[model samples]
Target: MANTRAAWARSHAKLDSDTIADAIRPLVEADPSIKVKSIITEVQSRFNYTVSYRKAWLTKQKSVVKVFGDWKVSYQTLPVWLKAMTAKMPRSRVQIKTLPVYRESEEVQGVRVLHRVFWSFYPCIVAFRHCKPLVQVDGTHLYRKYKGALLVAIAQDGNQNIVPVAFAIVEGETADAWEFFLTNLRRYVVTIDGVGIISDRHNSIDAAIARSNGYSRTEQEYNKNYQRLQERGEAYMHWCDEIGVDRWVLAFDGGHRWGHMMTNLVECINSVMKGARNLPVTAIVRFTFYRLNELFTRKSAEAHEHVRNGFTYSEFATKRVEESFRRAGSIVVNRFDRRNEVFEVREMPDGSIYTINLAQRHCDCGHFQVERLPCRHVLACCANQRLDWQVYVHDVYKMSKICKVYRGEFVPMGDPSTWAPYEGAKVIANWTLRRTIKGRPKSTRYLNEMYSRDMRGSRRCTTCGKEGHSRSRCPQHAGPSSTGGQS
Candidate 1:
């Protein structure tokens, strides 16, 4: 019997999703966003066996649960966790709306399903005050078990750093949802008057903006940097036709766009945070905490080092101002104001002349007022008069302000075992939104002929030669089939 059992064990062994998940627990704990293809290669390397794509995907889901806890429980504990976070870091704002649950004819007691949520960390709230007074808003789809849309607001620092200000999770980009997100964003994050909001002209956003004066932050506030934007021809005219030409056309904006051409700032933040969209709700929030904390800590230290190195302006401002100084040396200045602030500056040899107003921080070239930085003409005017040119540079460009942008640090969230008991209604999930079918759920997107063709002839991954996310984002940078130099 012992000889027969030994022969059977040598011939066969069981491979399952649970076993795969257990094997990759360390990798998942280290990096929760590790790719499934990496898991398959790792399992094969360890056990001398392979697993199917579906099983690998299942193992990932299980591993995520092991590392970050269950998705359903994440929803239930979200409010409690948020309360603890708020207590630890004062002034952090969070609003959660839950719909009441019902059974037959009677209402459920102390039970509710999540409707929407909005959060703005205190550090981000503080950071915005020191950034450029322009805000960019955008939304991206969430592809987890609970389908939702993440609305994000981003601001840009003097050094051109991306500052994520606020975020919200909603059912979709419906008018109501946009209204909720925009209203809260205006009230909480972008509280300054005369600030500009940059966004794509999505119909839902338009509808929400039209519904009330208080909805979108773009309620007649100005855009400053008209000269910097490279105007697109047809779409520019079409956008003018749809929403009054004032919003898109910088001619109407009173120098508030701040050298930004489009809504790329928010789009950039969306890409940076989209990797965690498929994570559990609590994990998504946790990911934000870790990501933003890392960002602030690094930037804060960098800003201090720059200050210690005797940098009065941010690196971005320093580079631009230095170039302006070089150009100012050659340009000839003609005094126009008795205060020695305003002048007409001409280029070296023979060139067109530009008007500069040091007091107003204006230039006929439009660089001074729009960018809030001293243009060549302004520098030339100041140099001809022997006046200090640093006075013309905006405070936002100063290293001191840049340091304040990241001064707020995130507090570590202690263990949950010490958390105070929550007194709010117990949260429930809307089961109707769950993918209740079998196996992996199919995309609900209506596949046209072109999409179908692409699906049929899809290309495989470059790194592992497997069909999925790209090489950089993929964990398996190389596969067994890849041949290279000596190991």
Candidate 2:
């Protein structure tokens, strides 16, 4: 029995990369972070063989590349992959921009170059047509050779489901790149007036939005007036003037921006694609396609299920309506006219009066105006007038509208070999964007004032248990040795 076991171990130890990769491909795909030791143990249990740690690690590396494709050769396949996607789904749009090698410019001569690329799938476009006009845009860094930035534009459906509309791969998060992305997005994705864009106060994004004529003049003037009343310094006021309050501030954006104040939705998309960022550009795009396909399939099914259950609105909207009804009891309604379309609701607890205009679907409190849902005041007025509050709710929140957004089917890109030839110049990573320094790359995120922590608050020292200083800077902790033996 011992001799047989030894023979089995020896046979397993001799397992080649291809054989080991085939065994672990499913495991890797399921959990990309699976350890080498786990793989070795699994191989030992399944095949009655033992493999070294180094061998297992090497096998896992090769297997990942095999399954996901080599990062080095991934960029060359992007055009073809996009072409196949567009063929399968004709409504899908893809644009690629490449920088030509110029002999006159010594800086860019004889280097791998692909400047930027943008793509928007058909289902996402169709879905956004039924969603709110608000969109959130943000960028995240890619991890791999020939590093670049991944720009994402996302919107929220009536059901509060995040719908990704467009994606772009740019050289970096510069003004030019953002402008290109916004230009493509405006032309192909969100070709509608009164669209609200939410993002962090990134200078590049502000410049891009300004150049694209993304906001209306009314929004600009509203922001200027709003900022003029603030106690912010002249420099901050000037900066706000340059960027325009309508670009980032929700209050000054009139009714176009809805209530979205930040690009958190786009950040969520970045987190979803965290694992794929380390892969090649083509693999990253492929991963996005598959992930989105999965999302659409699952969300569509969920929407259908909700509708089948006879839900009038989404679960979130339903809950909000119920909450408004509960609060409606304390609100006393007074009609302004006989039409009953306009009224004033006075809250008994605070004696604050809010005007509810059913015709405009608005309230003085701003909730009804921004969310397009009946506020507590509106609900109270509707109750007093024997009117249906549901009529005042926006069409986008209705179950029918939510269902329409996800009804479009996602067409599959059959096979790579079947893809038509892409005769464009072989796209490669711009080496300028690649990190030269060794250690793990660092990533930073910009946070709006609402999300940012108040570091100006008093801090306590860990050692002395006092406020206004840290442990390292605590005066009470100063030792006699530091006083040159004076103690």
Candidate 3:
């Protein structure tokens, strides 16, 4: 048995691993010529009869080391390899400095972090003595990856252009964030007495002001204004009073503070940036700069036209009005109950204003918010009354704001030569495979004769079940005329 196994091994052994393995597999199978030793049942096992040559061959086989083909390898392997390769490459360093670190009630020295920085110039109001009377402030959510919100402080300039003085991005829209943003913003905006600051009725600013007032020596004057919080917003007024921050009584819009008054310049800014909302962080900032440049361009043209048309910023009418109408006293204060869609219009009487009810479909003002134009109550009264509803409109709802922005000139950014459309994007054809037509049997004599005959045939109308005609030409389709047969 040992001699026979040796002879088998000699004949099967080949030059390469694959050929030797293939040749030995068949000999190990069940056979009559050699009595199988049955030392191992598995075909993968080699040489049941102990042999030195087979042992050496197995040892030198390199253990079938698996060098996996690219397709079979896991995706992470390439990156690991690349990282290893890059470790051999070189890099450079620049600056070093010392700074104070505050931690665990101790001051420690730390290297100062340096950034590649540049200076930017923003138009700021150093003195508010003769500045515009209206200051509009608003907050916007940052567009891209950075999780933060931006507070924009804007005002209408001499050219009727929205001048963004200072803006900041905070971690969140909390009172702390708003206070931090506003404290910095106030440094840029010079507020004159009687100048109204227009902003959403945010509690943070109120809370911060309240905190400041609490620390102020004039607590009596602050408490009087604090009592007026109830008149501002029932919820906000209560909240402010509870927090002891009630000094900004005159700072609010009286009725539905949101509806009658709020600064919507940020809304206009957002509308201008709607096209670039989903862009990358760098792109959004770049686009914002571009939009600013466009605003300046339009303002430059408007400035030239201002001199030609004798126009001033105050003379520029944001709202259209008909000539020959008195805008005062026409506005009757009205309350709209959205739940019931009813409007209660109050007209001032001898002592108090007289109240009238107008349903949702009909306002005493006589206008539905349809077409977004003021109705008669709003038109005759609000427009006639000189009341502004522009404040109540949510930032996104303003169509004119969006329309005016896109109309501004914008140069396409980046090099035209490097720009390329998505690669290999083909219009995929929705191909529907048509079933092959079963060839009609060669016209048999029996069918030909039957169909050809004018009156006699097996074919019949499927609908009416009449003989000698198909459903398409049935007499019922033609109408109850002479007969079922065609002419």
Candidate 4:
């Protein structure tokens, strides 16, 4: 049996690279995380053929490039791809900005290098017209040969579905880059007035919005406010003064923003595009187009089916309303005014009182005002007055509005062979932006408060029988006389 196995293994050891790559292409495309060792093992287990690690690695690389296209070529083909996309979908907007190449401080006249690219599909822009007026903007770094930042503007439709409206690839996250992105966004996609923008407390965002809005406040006046803010240790107040609270803060947004305080919506979209960010520029754009197409189709069908089934509210809103209704049963309500719109609600068990103002669509508890949905107090008041609770629900949460958001269809970009010839200058990446550090690239996300957990209790040192440091790094094991030396 050993002799027979040896002969079989020897015969299968020299597997053809092309054959191995062909067999692994589907697996690689299905999961980019598959290791070379795992591919070799899988090949052996599935095909009963042995392969070397180098061949497996090369095969994976070749298959990936073949499937996703080469990185440099993808950059070169960006202009053509954008032109083809716009031609296929005329309503879609695409803008490419380039700067002349500089050689040792002197510009190489007329030789342009890619500086930024901005685009918004027709379907996305049209869908946003029917969605909420609030938009969340955020930026994430690109993990590729030519390092850059991807800026995204995402909005939540009536169904609470994230609709990506615009995307921009910039040299980096700076004031000018954000200004360029938001300016184009305003000109192309979000043309409606009173549209609220939400983002983090990043300084660049503040400067960009101020510049875009053309704030004419004098520097001395601004400096006075800044000094006062610093003295009071109110940095957020300073930001609000500079960028206008209506643009970033939820309270001052006057219901235009619909109470979205964070850019988590755009961040969610960024996380969804994690794998694609490592691809070349054209591939990244293609991935987004295809992914959004899938999302629009799936969500539109869902909304249509829900409406057909007679659902007035979204699944999420329905669940929340039902939960509030149940909680309303335990509360007591007393009408305070002649119109019966103002009421005092008291929790039976705790004797906690809350003021509910149905006229203003607000409650002292704040949930009703922020969520635009009746809170338990408001629901209790409505129940006591025999008023319909459905009227308190926002129209944006209705199934009809949701269907309208997904009604627009995403047109397909036809075959590349049928594309019009790009008559403009070739757009090449800025060489200065290329990563020069010599080390293996890190694909892991930076640790944040949300993703981090207190693992101190789980960490136990085998050397000292203590918590915190590992056995290899344990101080007890680091001593010269300790038998358990550092590994």
Estimate, for each residue in 1-487, the C-alpha lDDT of model 2 and write its tens digit.
5345434534444477779999899987766557788999988898776777777877877777887888657777888788888989999889898876555666454344678999999898888899998899999887656667899999989888899989998988899999999999999989998888877656454443333333223344444544543444465456556876656554456777677655768889888877677677887788879888988899889988988999989888899999989888998889999998889888989898877788877677777877888889888988898998888888899889988888878877876687787776676766677778543335476767765447456776654566777756755456546667664
- Which pairs of residues clash in candidate 2, taking residues 3 or more apart in a chain or in different chains? none
TM-score of each: 0.80, 0.75, 0.33, 0.75
RMSD of model 4 against the true structure: 12.9
What stretches of model 4 exceed 4 Å from their correct place? 1-18, 31-41, 49-57, 102-111, 202-261, 437-487
lDDT of 3 by residue, 1-487 (tens): 5345334544444534444334444442222112123222322355342334443344222221111112112111222222222232211111111133346967544312111111111312321222244567776664322344555666554224566545443444678766755655454354343445667765365554444433322234445654554455678556655533222332222111112133566578766555443332233344444556566566556555544664322232323223213442444555445442334444445323322232223332212321223333444333423446443232222333322322333334345243333232111111121113322223455666555756464775544556677746755555556474568
Question: Considering only N, C-alpha and C atoms within 3 Å, which residue pairs clash in candidate 1?
Answer: 223-256, 223-257, 224-255, 224-256, 224-257, 461-466
Q: Estimate, for each residue in 337-432, the C-alpha lDDT of model 4 and write its tens digit.
A: 989789988898999888888989977666787678888888888778889988999888888888888777877777878788888777777888
In candidate 3 the C-alpha lDDT for residue 219 amounts to: 37
Candidate 1 lDDT, 371-390, residue by residue in tens: 88888888877777888889
Compared with the true structure, the alpha-carbon lDDT of candidate 3 equals 0.38
Residue-level lDDT for 451 in candidate 4: 58
TM-score of 2: 0.75
lDDT ranking from best candidate downward: 1, 4, 2, 3
Candidate 2 global CA lDDT score: 0.77
